[model samples]
Structures are given as structure tokens and as C-alpha cells.
Target: MESMMSFASDLKSVSPLTSGCALIGGVVVLLFIKKVAISAYKTFLRPAIDFTKLGKWAVVTGATDGIGKAYAFELAKRGVNVVIISRTESKLEAVKKEIDDKKYGVEVKYVVCDYGKFDTKARDMIAKELEGLEIGVLINNVGASYRYPRYFHELPKEEIQHLLTMNVDSTVWMTEMVLKGMVERKKGAIVNLSSAAARYTQPLLAEYGACKSFIEKFSCSLNAEYSGKGITCQCQAPFFVATKLAKMRKSWSVPTPEEYCAQGIKWIGYPDDIVSPFWIHATAGWVLLTIPQALTTAHFTQVLGGLRKRGIAKDANGGVSPQKTKKN
Candidate 1:
């Protein structure tokens, strides 16, 4: 019995030592992971554009209302000449007139083009319009979600095509076109507006979220590729920005348009860190690190679906609901 007690005590002592080593090892691993995450955040999340380093002109697409118009106004306030591109020339003209009336000492120009229905001619036209202009900043802010919330098969074929064209094709084409001049000069800032929907599992907005996911991933990869050079490519993904589009989504928490624009410009002009004001919503990077990409993608699809349903049902009146207006 005495020998048995001695062996039991020895086993207990050995078990504690083993547990202690394991605890220490776990802590070290966590610290290493934290270090890696911080390094990545600094490397990719940082903004590349320095407004003070900006040249003569800036181009803003979809610069008629909401977030795009706000970006134009902010740039104008900084005395940078702006070229506004949108489908509605009248709206562009109105914006120009307002800027001129403000006497902000910035020139405003407009290009009437629908990015959703892009063609070779439209691309050439934009290229011609941009010729000889030193464009220091390019804001790819034109994107659209479906008019009605539905599953993939339930959505109209035309609407799907339109969304894909506007959200993915036009954005990629515009970046590619503008990048020619920027790469030649080796100095330019490209700001692509992405979305938090990219991270969440949203079933109803599967395509929209997927497109945003593409933008986020593409921007990060592009930044890695071009950071060695002078050009900086930054993607700004905000949550529930208080734009005309968000206004239609009754359940969304709309951050003020002015605030969104300010944050976006700050990121575009001087991205040395993540530009998102609502960093709490940065689940994409976290999930990508913690879980498998496929799993995270699946989760985001489901989350987005719920959001889409809420967005559609909450504001079915076609007018800005009281809840949305109040939130804005």
C-alpha cells in the first residue's frame, strides 16, 4: 500500500508538469499567430494614396448620388479637379454647378456613360476623355444590387447580368484601363469600394457578396503585386453606408454618407492602415485566418441571404421608410 501511494504521488507530479508544458506551448503559439496577423494587417490593410502627393486630376465613377457624389464633393473641397462619370448627364451637370457655386477653386468635368452596358466604344471614349490628363486618383464606386430580393433562380436573368456587369466587369475594366497610365507614371491611387457582405453568409445576396469578395481579394493581391512600385491599390469595405442603396434596405444600419466618404477618402489618399471605420465588422480577415476559406464563404452566403430578406421586406414601400430615414 505504501508503494502504491508513492507511485500515485509520482504520477500526479508528472501530470502537472506535462500540463504546464502544454499551457506554455499553447501561449507561445497564440503569440506567434497574433504577431502574424498584425504583420498582415499592416502590410495589406494600409492605404497607399497620399492626397498631398496627388497630381492635377481625380476621376470618380457613379458620381451622381450617395457615396460617389460624396467622394466627388470631398475631392473638390480639397481643390482637386474632378471628372465625374455617370449615366445621367443632367445629374452630373447639377453636381458640377453646385461645386462651381461653392467657389472651391476646383474644375469639374463630366462623362456620360453607363458602366453596366459597357462596350469597346465606351471604353475607347473614356480612354480618349482621360488622355493627356494626369489622373492622380481613381475611385471605382459604381455597383448595383438586385432590385428584388430573391434566390439565384428566382432573380431575373437581366438583373443578374446587369449586376455582374456593373459590380464586376466595369470595375475590373476601369481599373485595367486607368492602370495603364498609372503604371506608366508609376504614381497613382486606386480606391475600390467593397462591402461587408463579402464576409457574412448571405444566401439571398450570394452573387453580390461573391462579387465583393472578389474585389477584396483582388485588391489585396493587387496591393501585394504593386506595393513594390509607387502605385497603391486600396479597397474600402464599409458596413451599411448611408447611401441611396442602403436607404432601400430598411434593416441596414446606415452610417452617414459624409462620414463614409470621409473615411473612404482618408483611406484612398493615405492608406497606411485599414480604412474601415467599423473595424468591428472585419470578420472576413478574421474568419479567413481562423477557419477554412470554403467554410467561411459558405457562412457568408447564408448571412447575406438573411440580410437581403430583411432589407427587402423592411422597406417594401419603394419610398424611404421612417426607420431608414431615422437611421440615416
Candidate 2:
């Protein structure tokens, strides 16, 4: 009887260290549950902002094709005119025609300047185009990445310059052009396209990811500063969007540009600074947030490295490598 009692006592004992870990785990789970509940409410039940009331026109950089174009179309359907900006003149004209001819019945205009080489002159040109427009929205969708996935050092000086100018400089400049109008009117919305890479550490695509991360941080601060002024600034982050930049065909996990933009447009004018518009991605995000940061980073590194290798081999004869990215 004595021996059996001693064995039972040993079975019931738990180390103090184990007890502390269990307590911490319980706290983390509760926090995660709260976040998910809030997210579900915002995503499913929260009403969207009525954009037609914001202004007469919405401006989208990189609006010739892909997500940018789709976003432009989405807004037009909601009765906002579109100002399209892209590098290629022919593509610009084509987009304008598509919108006009298809009877989107909204005014479509273009300002052609390569975001890759954007400078003071380019900024001035875009600002001039924006003048006198009842601008309600600005979509900073232009972005740059390596011809393929390249490490930070592996990227050339010129390529880095282009990436910075397109991704960072163009966004700030366009925002500067439109922000005053919004401030004066006390009504507007700004959507800056960011990437899930900002949330997920991508190893080989360091600079691109960093630039996207900068956009998210930058948009968040701006929203906080301007929300009281009647402006909604959003930084949208998505994973595996099917675009030319991504170079991957669409799947259930990867949405087409049109599909992605539909969700994105619905999310406009929401109070949230950072929003994952896709329901599937949002659900997956909840699970990922529960994971340990160190483990996720390690896993992302391996996955992105494999993607880089595959991209390099596919583009081996194309002079430039393929960059895994969303609508650029």
C-alpha cells in the first residue's frame, strides 16, 4: 500500500517550470482568440465605406494591367472616375480605351512616367495632372523587384535604385499630390499595396520585402495621423496573388487580380490600417499568428529559397530572373 501511494504522488507531480509554461500557453491562446473574434467581426459584419461619396475621381498608379487595373475597374463600377498612370504610352491608351469603350462611363485619363525613373520632374508632372480633380482616392500600386529573386548584395546598384524609386518614392510623391485635396475636403481614402512578405520574412527577396514592410509601416503611421481628419489610409497585405509579377497561375490559394481587387475594394475606407482582404488568407493568418515567430521565419526562409531557385532556372535564358511578387 505504501509503494502504490508513492507512485501515485509521483504521477501527480508537475515541475514548476512546466507549470509556468502551461500558464503562458493559456494566456497566449486567450489573446489569439480575442484577435480572431475581432477580425471575424470586422471582415464579415463591418460595412464598407461608400466611396462614391468620397470624390469624383480615383487615381491608380501602375494602372495599365494586373491588380492596379482591376482596382481601377472596381472603383469605376462604384461610380468614381479613374486617373491611370503607367510607363507605357500604348498600354495607357489601351486602358483608357478599354474603360471608355466598355462604357465604364467614367472619365479615364493618363499620366505616363516610368515609376522606375521617377524624379522631381515626374512628380511635378503627376501633380499637374492631379490638379483641379476632385480626387477621392489614391492607389499606390506600382512596385519593383529583381528580375528574379536575388540577395541584397546580389542586386545591382541601378536595380536597387529603380526598386526604391518605384516602390517607395513614387508612393510618397503620389500621396503628397493627393493628400492636400483630401485634407482640404476633409474626405478621402488612400490604399497602398503591400505584400505578405512584409509580415512573413522572405530570405532571398530581402530588399523587396523590406520596401513592402516600409510601405506598411508608413501607411499605418499616416492613417493614425490623418484618421481624425476624415481620411482612411490602408496598407493591404496579401499572399500569392496571381499576377505577372507573381508569375504563378491562379489557384484557390492564389487569387486572380480581379478577384483580389474585388475584396480589396470592399475593404476601402475601413478603420483598420492593415487588412488581409481575402477570407482564405485571413483564416490562414490566424493560424500563422499562433505559431512561434522563430519557427515561421525559418520555414519561410526555406520556402522562399526554393522558390528563388525555381525562378532562376525558369528564367535562365531570359536575361533576367523572375521575381515572386504580387501585382507590381
Question: Each prediction's TM-score against the native?
Answer: 0.75, 0.85
lDDT (Cα, 0-100) at 47 in candidate 1: 54
lDDT of 2 by residue, 1-328 (tens): 9999998888579787887999999999999899888877776777667788999999999999889999988988888899999999999999898888878678988989899878888888888888999999999999976677767887779988888898999888889899999999999999999988888777788888889999999999999999999998999988878889887799998999998888888788876899889888887776888899899988878877777687666667364434433223
> Model 2, clash count?
3
For residues 1-328, what per-residue lDDT tens digits would candidate 1 score against the true structure?
A: 9999999888788877798999999999999899769655644575534453666789999999988999899888887899999999889899999889999898899999998888889989998898888888888889997664568887778888888888888788888878878778778788888887776555677788889888878777787777776777788777777667875442334556676676566567443323454443344355455887678767766765666666566567464554776688
lDDT of 1: 0.76
Superposition TM-score, candidate 1 onto the true structure: 0.75
Error of 1 at 289 (Å): 9.0
Task: Give the per-residue Cα lDDT of candidate 1 at 272.
Answer: 39
Window of ten residues with lowest summed lDDT in model 2? 319-328
The regions of model 1 sitting more than 4 angstroms off are 1-52, 248-253, 269-275, 279-328
Off by over 4 Å in 2: 1-34, 311-328
Compare the candidates by lDDT and give the number of the best one: 2
